[model samples]
Target chain A: MKLINKRNFISIVCIFFTLITCGKLLYERALNFTDRYYTDNIFTILGFSVLITLILSLHFYLQKFPFWLVIIAQYALTVGIVFLAIFIHGRFSTNAPTAYWDMFVSITIPFLIGALVYYICFFVQIKRANKVLEKLNSEE
Target chain B: MKLIKTREENLEENYLELHYDKIDEETNAVLDRLRDTLRYIEGTYEDKKVTIALTDIFYIETVDRKTFAYTKDMSVEIKEALKDILEEYSKIGFVRISKSVIVNIFKIKKLQGDINMRVIIFLKNDEKLIMNRSYKNDFYKRLNDLKGRSAK
Candidate 1:
């Protein structure tokens, strides 16, 4: 976000909100996924912050790629991340959920929603900018 | 600022020229506008020399240190560095997007930005360019100027 700049006040605000949001998700996961809850710590907070930042930075870089490529890459990346987490926790059991595609659905749907929100916000920003440009043009 | 008037009548053409002891920022900006309006940078294409009107260019980009100008139907390699070309055409409409790219705001069809960090600038030719976050402000400022002029 443009909030992450040299200005201390704005950067701090951005970081504060980021931590709050990520921390809330982690807390919810800890309540639901007990086995994975043990790994939560300061390192976990730091890790989540870094991971979220990297994923969001893709929005800026993804413009260089085609729409379809971005979709495939994002899908692969999300699945890869979930697999990595499972490996780290040593959860290798072949459950019924795997057969039913539970893990895949859980990981992919949120990412799709994220992509949707991103485009909606993008359209809103463009509309606002065009409106301002129109107002400026209408002036002397 | 000083204004000097001359009464020399020209039979062939009439024009204004600036003779300044030192070129300040404002004076240099005015000079850039005058030069870009009348100047046509030469390029080589298909083993032939082609002169490009600065305003007609949609964008100029450098790939592997070679600069090419993109118009509607022509892609001509110009004998100029990207930075130099930007300076020469800056007053007309071009603004740098990335390290190796500069685009003319007048040629842009639409602009959209995402939270993902990249802004999409659609050209009149339907080609899209990624607007780096670093150069977004300058691009919009130039766009505003272009819009104002079109309205007038």
Candidate 2:
């Protein structure tokens, strides 16, 4: 296995921390919107979000495949994580069946937003690199 | 008993070995001629002193009516037009991949498809070059020819 450089390690840590904090605040807001509607397991939701965030970060950092693969993987992982969160919460209540569609929509919206953000970041990086290359070539 | 009686034994190697040596010699001579021609071209351009390895150059591009050679290390401005360079090096694996780009087929790391029939060429150094729609057919033909030659 390749050792992570200090810069990349720090970046990953920052990303992880930021995602966790935001996820916490969002979870709180979600709870406020429908009090006692979700499973009282904050840890489970946080765990799922962290897992998804790490996967997305890995995809972004490595970038082993083509751009299309990266985008597809990001969307798939985000959607999967959202469903996992709903499943984890729904397991504890008898009202789980009734909340299925509502849970789907709630989970999906955040993931779509996150995917769009990820894509924009990826595109911007590519554009910047291309511009640098163009400038270097132009100098010659 | 009959074999033992024969004055000359059977040849250990096949006749193909002799032909292979001749082909090798011919190939080496051709390569030498190509190198000499490239050296002559390099001598003609006095302003730019460049030693471009066949393996290092990813492609050549024309920008703002000036032609530049793009290598892994750096891009070098060439006084010669793209057509002149293409004429000289196309025989040695360089190919016109687009209107403004002529790529060394050996330096391509991977090929990716962009939207609307365009393709992106990823060089070994991680730089991306585009293959325009118009030159796609000719590009592939040249690429295939290089692959065929290499395989032999």
Per-residue alpha-carbon lDDT of model 1 for A1-140, expressed as tens digits? Answer: 34233445444545744655565567668887543433443343345344544554564555456555676686787568756765655565533434226446554554577678856865766776667544543541
**Where does the lowest 10-residue lDDT sum fall in candidate 2 chain A?**
A131-140
Poorly placed runs, candidate 1 (over 4 Å):
A1-46, A55-63, A90-113, A128-140, B1-32, B35-38, B44-52, B61-77, B96-101, B109-152
DockQ of each: 0.15, 0.01
True contacts kept of each: 0.12, 0.00
lDDT of 1 at A93: 50
> Considering every candidate listed, which one attains the maximal lDDT?
1
Clashes of 1: 4
Which tens-of-lDDT digit does each residue in B29-122 have in candidate 2?
A: 7557456434523311247576665545678888999777776667777677778877877866677876688887666666666533246778
Superposed by TM-score, candidate 2 places the C-alpha of residue A130 at a distance from the truth, in angstroms, of 22
Q: What is the per-residue lDDT of model 2 for residues A1-140, given as tens digits with 9 covering 90 to 100?
A: 22234446655545655665566568779887544534443444455455555665564354335555665676677667667666775577454564556545544665677667845654554454344444434432
Q: In model 2 chain B, which range of ten residues has the least summed lDDT?
A: B13-22
Q: Which stretches of candidate 2 lie over 4 Å from their true place?
A: A1-140, B1-48
